[model samples]
Target: MKIEQQYFENLLEEGSEEFELIFRSLFKEKYENLYSLLDDTDAFNEPMICAAFSTPIHIPVEQMVLGFLEPLPSKIDVVSNKHGVVHIPKLGYFYTNEPCESLEIRIKDNNSFAIFKSDKEVELISFKEEVYINDTDIEICRSEDESIIQFFPDQTENIQLESGLEKSVMHLNNAYHLIKKHTPFYAEWLNYTMRRIVLFTSPQLNSFASICTLNNAYINLNNERVSDIFFLEEITHQCGHALFYPMSIDRDKLFIMDYTTPMSHFSGIETDDRDLINAFYSFFPQYTGNYIFDVILDHEENLDEDSRLELIGRYAFRMYKYGLGIYQYQEYSDQILSEYGKEMFAIFREGYEKLYEKRKELFDSLDIKDQVYVFDLEKFKSKNLQKTI
Candidate 1:
């Protein structure tokens, strides 16, 4: 468990033979189990090797591991001026006692890059969330050791109060996902901007909400407080833009794609990485990276950027009361709409209230005092009136 930092740093620093050894060993488990060498091919291109072994690898293997100095059976092990000492566990992978001075890795599925630090544990940092709100100040102190990752808030950001990040890592299926659906979030109420609502229907886990980063979008679904009270909070947070986004941005913004709706939602694909921006009214909703906004009824979008984000937040709040999850009530004849006078809101409304009540009963039983944003229809209506019409 304890490793010498200087040892691994040498691999890349000096291009030492040991560096190659370490990489080959560590990656053996990956190539042996996860890869297939189809033809009589002994070695692949460096990129191909790195792709199979450890992806988002700084120097994509491009022939580092299987570049046959000996037969494919005999592996290489050496010490480099840069990489201290390495031992290849398998032909294409290596393990070392030290951390590489500098390494870059990306999730093969998402291609999100992380700068590997030369610490005892493998560490990666994310500045997008931090820099988006404040540049000079550190935004997130997220760190990880091996598969388990943690989220932390920076001290110097000038943001008052502290957030104790919850840590949970699961090597479930493809990758590790650590979710935070718990709070005070510092006792901060679940407004549209920060709401966790999830509706998971996996064979393994039937969950209401969770927070995780996937290939497409950063997603967070909260139910840790009310535990299924507002099942749509997270979903609506992302989908609200589908209703409130303005088509045009008055000022240039970096992250806000497509006035209110993402390019994916308009395009109709549930999740796509390359093409982002729903320029054409296709209404394909982005289902990844903070995807929770529910947009089936309200169609008018924001032409200006300011109006778009504001409306997004507003509509997200609306989802606390109305989301597709609740509207699935069998009693409603025309589920999407309830007509001018007669309200089917009561149908979904009644069901959600029951769900909320059930959650409250559970919370009371558990003695948890977290505050959940209860959907008060009257108050929600009043809040909507203040928005710029």
Candidate 2:
């Protein structure tokens, strides 16, 4: 399975229609019979439908496929995307209006079941998970089935879940506008890849810890004061990993070893090459977002003084991680990337180098000594205020 360099490069490029078609073709091949059977369903044709096959949080593809083996109104266990909504195979969806994990639903039993609503045809079931934390109820943001943005209930006294969720959503919207305004292709790429955003509290992390698998991103928001630029960096970084996962499904095509090798858990232990490459690749887009922020801070006016300074500080913090990621992964890439993978790595490195050169002056202006790994608003503002902000 000798894939071309263009295929690898296009996958990293983030907005290649050709690569999207390639992904669909590969996905179809993986589930040939199932794909053909449910080709006409609206659920199968969604832009972000690939998200359903992701690990940890996913609508089980096997169960949906198995549902087709039975009759039209078969009994199948389906998981809800948000709280109470479930998408049935062949038939439409049903709502339960409560927290749910998985429930058995009668697809189209006219005689044996009662309709919950007149418009949609789905039989309701009796299975609900209580949505509570410390005897307090928390709200869930139920967006469309294609994409969901959810927040974890407050765990600590300092944690303000409602305010944090609202502000994070605003930052996500603003980040999309920045990407669209600067790089429209990147914005479209984000729409196609990112499916869910989960904001939670993590006391162990100083500022935050964000990790993404497939279309889902889990962001720890233990820190109170997060800048607008922080969202820009994490959104792109997490989504970048989401996009890269499917592309590397065929291990022989991209890597010398099995690409699905689990990451090392022990401290100072070497991780698999796949993890290293993906980590470095995720930073490529983060740097692109940084580049966009630089342009925004330089040209865009009427921004609040504090906001500008905040962005500059976070931008500097993100830039350090972006550079360090690529530097750490350079040796691993040389050891494990196949011929096609090498070409892709070369292209990614070249892209980062270009952005680095352009941002040289901005880098020189920042006080590197005061810059910290975790986002510190005061430290960032104090050290990075040398500029016109």
Candidate 3:
């Protein structure tokens, strides 16, 4: 049987009680039908409803409480927890989990160093006190300078410490809170992304999947509600980039676009250029089916230079190629360009005239005059450059 099925069965066998209690308790009001359906975890994985069904399932209890309702009334001021303090909104101070360490996070609440011990026990410490911050044990944020004591992990990205709070507090505090609250969900999310769909990878990649949230951009799971559902879909998109982010984006090694010289690489869209479009077509015939590509390359048939460049950001051949490696290049297509072969990549030419105008418009608007990397057009055209048949 498929692993998906096995996963469902396991949920039923072991997760039934937890699932029922959690579902009923949380969805008692808004999602009555969905809560009722919780009796069958197996049915929840149905294809059509899976997307819609799973959408709401993402709103775990704390997310609901933290995201929607305020856990506490405005009048209350103390926020305490043994499980660790998660700074909830008007829910102002609700400790979702117990504090693991006796972390004394000091914050300036009322012009005084209101030291927080385990999300509870607020103490006013004198500025003159020999307050030594335990980098590993406690996280501190005050006067706009929030810091995780002295955390400078060896492999972390090196960012210059800017002055004040921007360098410290907010992000780390928020990240810690989000990661603490959503560890399980994060693990499951990583599992979904790294499962069968990750056609080719190494243990390093599998490990990297867990560390994705560590990227400051996605540190806080709650902020993923930007574009459509807060840029959450974009999260997967970025992870897709990360999953295949190669040291060198080369067609010989990765799927991508090819262009020589920094200036010609992406300064502007080469409109109605049969050479460029034909080159694009020579690699990715799947563009015929991609809606976004179709809109930019196949639909808007009469775009000028300015128009084409504007839509440049939307049309990334590498992204399309990544999709190809993911869904198309595998078992789906028999077409061979050899090892890294593409079937003539001629499909992109079929709608050339029709797509030329719009595609140029997209390319024209883009200001990519600064990609110093020696980007190979074919390499630039592919998605995941690390796969082999």
Question: Which candidate ranks first by TM-score, i.e. highest?
Answer: 2
| Residue runs of model 2 more than 4 Å from their true location after superposition | 1-9, 12-37, 41-164, 204-213, 224-227, 247-275, 331-333, 368-373, 387-389
Please provide, for model 3 over 1-389, each residue's C-alpha lDDT reduced to its tens digit, 9 standing for 90 to 100: 00122332343334333433433454546556544534443222111122222333211222223213222212222332222343322112333233433334343444233445546754333232111112222212121011111122222332222222233344333322332233333323333322111111112221112221111111122211112111122223333232221111233322233322222133244442323222332232222223233433344554454333322323443333434333322342233233332322322333332344444554344333332122222332243222210
lDDT leaderboard ranking? 2, 3, 1
List the candidates' TM-scores in order. 0.22, 0.61, 0.27
Consecutive 10-residue window with the lowest summed lDDT within model 3:
141-150
lDDT of each residue in 1-389, candidate 1, tens digit only: 11122331332234323333443555555555423441233333122242334323333232244332233422122221122212121221222333333332223334332333332234332222211111111011221111011111121221111121221111110011111222212111112122111121122222211112110111232223222212233332332232112211111231233333433443345664323222211121211111222221133342244333333433344333233333332233242222421232343355344433533432233211221343343343344434423
* TM-score of candidate 1 against the unseen true structure: 0.22
lDDT of 1 at 33: 43
Q: Alpha-carbon error at 277 in model 2, in Å?
A: 3.3
Arrange candidates, best TM-score first.
2, 3, 1
**Which 10 residues in a row give candidate 1 its minimum summed lDDT?**
168-177
lDDT of 1: 0.26
Q: 233-340 in candidate 2: lDDT tens per residue? A: 666655556556555544466566655443342124564443544454565455456666667776767567777777777666667666766665565665666888
Which candidate tops lDDT? 2
User: What TM-score does model 3 achieve against the real structure?
Assistant: 0.27
